[model samples]
Structures are given as C-alpha cells and as structure tokens.
Target: MTKQLPYSDAELAELIRNGDAEAFRSLFERFIRALVYFGVKLTGDQEESEDAASEAFQKLWQKREDMRGYPEMRAYLFSIVHNRSVNFVKRRSMVKAAHQTIQAEGETHSDSSITTRIIQAETMVAIHNAIDKLPLHHRDLLHKIYIEEQSTTDLAKMLGTTPAHIRTSKARALASLREILSDETLLRSCIVFFFLFSAK
Candidate 1:
C-alpha cells in the first residue's frame, strides 16, 4: 500500500509554494470534487460548476503561497469557487433573460383566443431560454435568490453588500436582461450556447 500522507492546510500550502507536485496532487484530490459539487449547487449548471471548480483550483495552484495563514482553507477555496460561479451565472442570466423576454413577447397574442396552457408552456420555455442567455452576474443573482431560494439577507451578507443593494442589483440586472432580449430574434428551433469556451 502507498504510504499515507498526513498534511495540514498550512503545510500543504507551504509544500505547494515550495513547488512540491505531490502536495498539489493531494490537495486537488481532497477538494476538487467537493468544490465542483458546491459550484453546481450554487450555479444550477453542472458544466459551468465543473469549469468554475477546475478554474478555481488552477488559480489556487498558481497562487499556492497565498493560501498560507488563511485560517480556513476550505472557506478560502469555497470563496474562490463562489466568486467564479457568481460571475459565470450573472453573465449567463443577462444573455438568457433577454432572449426569453423577446421570445415570450413574440409568442404572446393580443387575442385571448390562445389556450392558457399553451401560453404558459411557451412562456416557460422562453423564460428558460432567456435565463440560459443571461450575463453571469444576473444569472447568479437570479439563481441564488429565486432558484436556490436564499434569503435576501443571507445573499447580501455573502455578496458583501446590503440587502437593499442586492435588491437593487436584481432589479437592474432584470431590466438589463429585458432591454437586451426585447428584440433579438433567433430561429425558434435553435439554441444559443455561451458555454462554447471554458474559462481557463
């Protein structure tokens, strides 16, 4: 059996800073999957979560020395993950919200002749499609507040802003999404993806 390596976060940080590849590998093994799961939970997108977690780990490796004296290694790692996930979600929200708004408007008819069920179905699709296009910040806000059902106070605290600020940000983000997606029309059957390139 391979010898077990017992290391503290500070020691591991030192090892990484000293350019110990084995230490880095150990650290990656310990945290990568957990970070990815956390990212997915926060962002509600598996691929984006994976990308964020991977990118965050890459960044940590690049700046290993900075991890020293962090008091809480897990917290520090999760912080990076949170920031990256938030940014990704916001960007997506902006783009997707816009697209959804336009699509929904296009499908809505003035005549009350259309079945309510059909309208709801089409509107839901438009909503999801637009959400898919939103900017990372906006998308992140929506997911945290609405999808994840986080309390405004908790979100504000996590974001380092006040509850009022969070509310304002959400409003502005929504407005921005509406403005962008109000008119842009793509083929109804086609899907637009912003995830073509992963963040390195």
Candidate 2:
C-alpha cells in the first residue's frame, strides 16, 4: 500500500462537508496541536486550552455540512476556542473573587503558617460563594480580568469594547460586590490587597 498524502486545507474542508470521517480526523491531527498552543496563549492554561480545542473540533464536525467556504470554517473553529477559553477564565475568576470575599469575613486562623494557608483557603471559598450570587454580567467582568488573566488591551480587543468601558464595568462590578458584602472596612482592605498582590 502506498503512504497516503496529507490533504490540503481545501481538500480537508470539502472532505469534512462530504461526511468523510477520515478527512475530519486528518484535519484534527494537523491542527489540534497548533490550535492548542494558540488557545493556551489566549487562556494561559494548557488543560483549558485542550478542552477548548476539543470543543472547537466537535463543533466543527457537528456543523461541517452547514459550513461554507474555507476561511469561514477556520474562523468559526477558532472563534469557538477563543470564546470557550474566555468563558472558562471568567468562571474561574468569579470563583476566586468569591473566595476572597469569604475569607475577609472570617476570623484569623492560628498564627502558624500552615494554619494561615488553611484559613486563607477557606476564606477564598467563602468569597467564591458570595460571588456566585452576583448578577451574570458582574461576574463575567470580574472573570475576564481576574481569573482569565487577560491583558486589558487584549480583553478590550476580544470584547470589541473600549478599555474605558472595561474599566468602568470592572469598577461597577467591584462597587456592587462591596455593596453585597456590606463591610466597608473589609472592602477597603480588599481593594488595597487586591492591587498590591495583582501588581506582583
């Protein structure tokens, strides 16, 4: 048997649309690794990137027949990855913010470092629970910058909104969080500590 030649991007697209499973497999083999790397660049987590890539492929396969034109297919596939990665980061950030909120409400744990870490972990969990209660948009904004670790410029580009809009959204979210927690002193400390730790 002769060794099979790799499909061109055009051939791959046509094959996929024609319900050729082998063509889809070949396309995945060709692009999955590079796509994963690109996803990680956007999401900063290998596991999340892998998941996003897998989901993108699944979506491509599912909608292959309806997909038109090679460029559009590629764009749609990547858009899935980008959106999934961003959403993943957003959820994680909301949880982190919530945990912080909870911890600040708790008493100091034992002075031992180990105990402190435990208490801090508990605090973080509590904070997450509180954030879980926030409105969807507020939680989403926090997740974009805090959990997903996206640069403001990149986030602005991704969201197709201005940096000032992002800043205002973040500000409004933080204000709402403070109101929810209803602890002025804790909110002040959170603001200070958040900036200090983030800068590092």
RMSD of 2: 22.9
| Per-residue accuracy of model 1 over 1-200 as CA lDDT, tens digit each | 12222333455556567767776666665566667766675578989878887877787777766665424555566667677766776767667777554432222223342234233433554455567678898989988988899999999889899999999989987887676465323412121111111111
Clashing pairs in 2: 98-127, 98-128, 99-124, 99-127, 99-128, 102-127, 103-123
For residues 1-200, write the lDDT of model 2, one tens digit per residue: 12223333555577679877766776675456656765676568999888888999998988998988566676676668767766776676667777554433222223364334333433554465457667999998799889988887888899999999888888999888767665432432343333334434
Cα TM-score per model: 0.43, 0.45
Instruction: List per-prediction Cα lDDT, in the order shown.
Output: 0.62, 0.66
Q: Model 2 — TM-score against the truth?
A: 0.45
Best of the candidates, TM-score: 2
Best by lDDT: 2
